[model samples]
Target: MRRDDRENWRRVSRRRFIRLTGATLSLAPFIPLHASAAAKARIGVLKFGTVSWELDTITHHGFDRENGVELDITYFAGEDATNVAMLAGDLDIIVTDWLWVSRQRAAGEDITLIPYSSAVGAIMVKEASPIRAVTDLTGRKIGVAGGPIDKSWLLLQAFCQRDHGIDLAAQNDIVFGAPPLISEKAMQGELDAVLNFWHFCARLEARGFRRLIGTNDAAMALGAKGPVSALGYVFHEDWARANPQAIEGFARASAQAKKLLATSDAEWLRLAPIVKAEGTELEKLRDRYREGIPTRPVAEEEADAAKLYLVLAQVGGQRLVGQSPEMAPGTFWEGMPK
Candidate 1:
């Protein structure tokens, strides 16, 4: 009763312990070894902005999750509103031109830029218009989107003055208005030529408007060796430095999204509604977007930006470039993944 029964009980207990241990080990693969704590990045973007396209792709494909970050997006009605939100510490990131980032940095904000898109507007005319060249714009009524100090407008002026020896600002009847308004006026034949943002230009081009000159070409004429990203992701330098892993993950996720968009026509097809384009308009938008993806090194981009900055400053004056005649140091975030 003592020895044999005790032996049997010990043997059964040992078998039960082994079975439970095996079960636990088998279930371990399904359980999280460590709780997920992905970094949170609050980004502000315009409601209908192109940046939304990439953000959508990143989220839809789980690129952000794959890179160990979580994106919290806020949509704004206007670029100024997004900028204000960023300044008020409501947002950690926003899409804007590096020039604006430079201005902010110069004013002690310590913001930095990461390249986004190089696509810019073009000088477009109706199919039958006689405006064959930049010089032909003389005495013509030109509708300029983004106002007098728009980087595109200033680049156009700089190009004309440098290459054609004509001051376009003085020679042409310039009409400043919103991008959609300018496009509408151009469509109605009220404007002899229109310089609108790339998306508007794509829409106009789909409707048979001819591109007289692209701002990229103008940028080249003004001394940029390659495509220069006019717009980029802007964020506070202190915030980026404190969250290096999150920022780097974001950069990689962004790059992966761009690569997907660049190579996959299927992605563009999915983005058609967001882009508000179709057929020729969609094709133009897709092609232009692919063309704008940054290919050169950061140093090269910064160098070209410096040269373009001088040209912009010459035309846009202190109002456009702010207190800094040159791009502020560390305007482009060097921590970006290669």
Candidate 2:
């Protein structure tokens, strides 16, 4: 080959390489990045909380990644620890009741809540007990979980007073204790009736205890239009505003996980070990969890919460509701980021 021809070929090759590189660079804006490159959110959760069920489902199904967020989970053994972590800025999110968020907001903390579950406690008694009516509970020993200001117990008191003309706190022998302790004592027949959390109530139901009255029933009797969420995913409003994508993505992933759990029995079976339930207990847990999933609009939930807040204030006094006689504005976060 001639030297001139070889030089011409080398120039053409270099020109072709530069043109291809420029074309590739032009297409760079159109190429999608991997999901791992998305935003990250740090969430604190109770080690054995029901929230874990939904979170596990999200992780297993890659819902977070699909929604453009990566979840960084930290587990705590107690609710107080998780709350502390959240308040101290160690976590971006935590699950808690909206009442607490309202109290915090009333104190000027600027936190807000998104609905998680409407499940609440119930007045439970053994299947063979003769406590067929609220009147029958008069003079009976009642074990209450979450102390005197517990929302369920306070609601029950208001319900009884209005519907049956009975003041439960004065008429009954009230015993306050932790949820697990109260549940165990109730199982051992140490109390005539027990007002306990929803999960404990489900366990008692599986063990043949009868739900004398659910908190939902009392709420309805007291004028709630539908189920009211007692608990939700709470976070700082400032943080939510700053990381809009992360916050909204987490909410969407959470909702998808709830939908999956609501429909798939196989998902529940996969969660059996974590739930520590089997047979009837598993079924009870599954059904109760499904029932707890929040489906109502945020406006409806906030409206119901406002009504219930007044009821709680009447029964619980300033100690329970803090300085707020009414639920603080922005207690229930409206959907999506602004």
Name the best candidate (by lDDT): 2
lDDT of each: 0.90, 0.92
Tens-digit lDDT track of model 2 for 213-304 = 99999998998999999999999989988988889999999999999999999999999999999999999989999999999888998999
lDDT value, residue 318 of candidate 2: 93
- lDDT for model 1 comes to 0.90
Tens-digit lDDT string for candidate 1 (23-112): 999997887632376788999999988899999999999999888889999999999999999999999999999899888888998889
What is the TM-score (0 to 1) of candidate 2? 0.91
Model 2 gets an lDDT of 0.92
What is the Cα-based lDDT of residue 20 in candidate 1? 100
Evaluate model 1: give its TM-score: 0.90
